[model samples]
Target: MISELVMVPTDEAVLTGDLVVPGHVPAVVLFAHGSGSSRLSVRNRAAAAELHKAGLGTLLLDLLSEREEREDAATARHRFDIPLLSRRLVAALEWLAQEPNTRDLPAGLFGASTGAAAALMAAAERPERVYAVVSRGGRPDLAGDAIERVAAPVLLIVGGSDEAVLGLNREAAERLSAPHEIHVVPGATHLFPEPGALEEVAEVAGRWFLAHLKERRGPGGRRA
Candidate 1:
């Protein structure tokens, strides 16, 4: 419940996020927030807090520049840009890999909406570095070519009624060579911010990361 927020200097802008370290951090999660959202996004911040309670360290990152956000950012209603966001997500990972308190943590990604695509793209680009991936109402189809290359196990969490995106996620799942699963939150919509919905997403994601980020495994869940 009591977590700390900090900003680390990236090669470019100073990257900001909260880090919640448990008694012994079993793994780390880097949060990629969706369109027009910042590291302060409440759903992500809450999820990070829960993950820390579940024994994972969290780094919730902001994925864009003020200038780019103002000029090219999506409108309040529709602001999802996959490609531009992906690059920034990757850069944030590179920054985390060097930051002292986080450097050696076995890293995973928790991405929402378009942020999911960026997380997948980063996982693909830095296969050896990223250990697991989870997408909440993700548009990972937007990741296109990068989805097939991801080395970590991926969990795609979508709202059952978010039909079009669900189809896109299924299509992307077929292309992934990594160990993967797609779980739909029944009766939920794109946001999955409904009561108990975010909680379900966090629980599933924590379990997935625990399975994949470990040094040894024996089918509490599958692995790639």
Candidate 2:
């Protein structure tokens, strides 16, 4: 696997990112990090590293501006700014779609917290481009009415100890029309705080991406 720190040239300054290209490149994962966290989030970076080893590429980008992060941290709305963050995720997706390394390849999303909502919103906005989504202890309710508009499969991974959040993910899962599943990590906290729990997340995520990110033709798995 080859990893590099890069930038996605966008209208809103340059979106900083980490690119990890695996040997086979079965799919590309666009990550949306949780609140107050940057692309350097250790948990997400760990998952991305495993995905890379499993022949999957990943682009982890900052979902908020430095100024926005500071303000949002002060008000705690930066992580909850569903609309603004979702739009940014969509822009990053479109930008990735135009990149030579990821263009024409199946794409997946790995989102945590409100970032999950942003990922879901982007999937709804660009159904044809996103093949799958994986949410880790995310607040999918922030996606609002976009849930039904999403055409790809979604996997919601919640921590068992995070009972309240798990319930929310269950409700969100019910509203998703596409193929979906909810997996609970027993004894883990909201952030999968338990030891070795994040490793489980990485394995589950690898399987999901491998299963769905393959060449899906159409409704009947036909090549359009």
Candidate 3:
């Protein structure tokens, strides 16, 4: 595997990330962390490790710059700014397309909490480039109208005990015209802190990304 720290330049800011590409992988999953989170989120890193074992690359980045994170932390301003987050994700997608090491592989998005909304918005804005998306305990409903425009297959994974978020996912699923599925981890909570819950998430997500991103196809074997 090739692992490196990289900087992704956006129109507004330069974001930092860790890029890990396992040899001969079919796709890379870009991680969008939720509010108050960053590239170093433990759960996301753990999930990325699982993806590596499955022959997939991963890009985990801080959507906000250091200054922005600090400011947001103080004022609680930027974390819920979905449009800003989406723009950052879209910028990262563009960067991936031009980056020498990752240009040949298809791309996927793995988002948690509010990051899922940003992922969906980015998928809508760059339909041809993003092959698939997976949401872990996400609030995809916050994508607003962009939720209806996303063309890639999506997998929405929610904890069985996270009732409010699960209901939101189901409601969002209705607005999505693209192929999607809701997978509930039995007896798990928002962060999947249960004994085996997170492992189940990583396994299911790995399978979903492999299925859709490997072939750039939707459900029923149709090209996306």
Compared with the true structure, all predictions reach lDDT values of 0.80, 0.86, 0.94
RMSD of each: 3.7, 2.3, 2.5
TM-score-superior candidate, 1 or 2: 2
| Location of the lowest summed lDDT over 10 successive residues in candidate 3 | 215-224
lDDT of 2 by residue, 9-122 (tens): 656656778887776575799999988898999999899888887888999998777777788779987688788788888888888788777776778999999899999999
- The TM-score values for the models, in the order shown, are 0.87, 0.92, 0.96
120-201 per-residue lDDT for model 3 (tens digits): 9999999988989999999999999999999999999999999999999999999999999999999999999999998999
Task: Using lDDT as the measure, name the better of candidate 1 and candidate 3.
Answer: 3
The local lDDT score (0 to 100) that residue 211 gets in candidate 3 is: 83
Stretches > 4 Å off in candidate 2: 215-224
Question: For model 2, what is the alpha-carbon lDDT of residue 178?
Answer: 93
Name the lDDT value of residue 192 in candidate 1: 81
Let me know the TM-score candidate 2 reaches against the reference structure.
Answer: 0.92
lDDT assessment of candidate 3:
0.94
Which tens-of-lDDT digit does each residue in 1-224 have in candidate 1?
A: 22677665545566666766665675678899887788888889778878877888888876755655575554553356676566666776776678766676668999988889989998998887789999998888888899989988999999988999899999999999999999999988888857798899889989988877763333673232
Quick one: ranking by TM-score, best first? Answer: 3, 2, 1
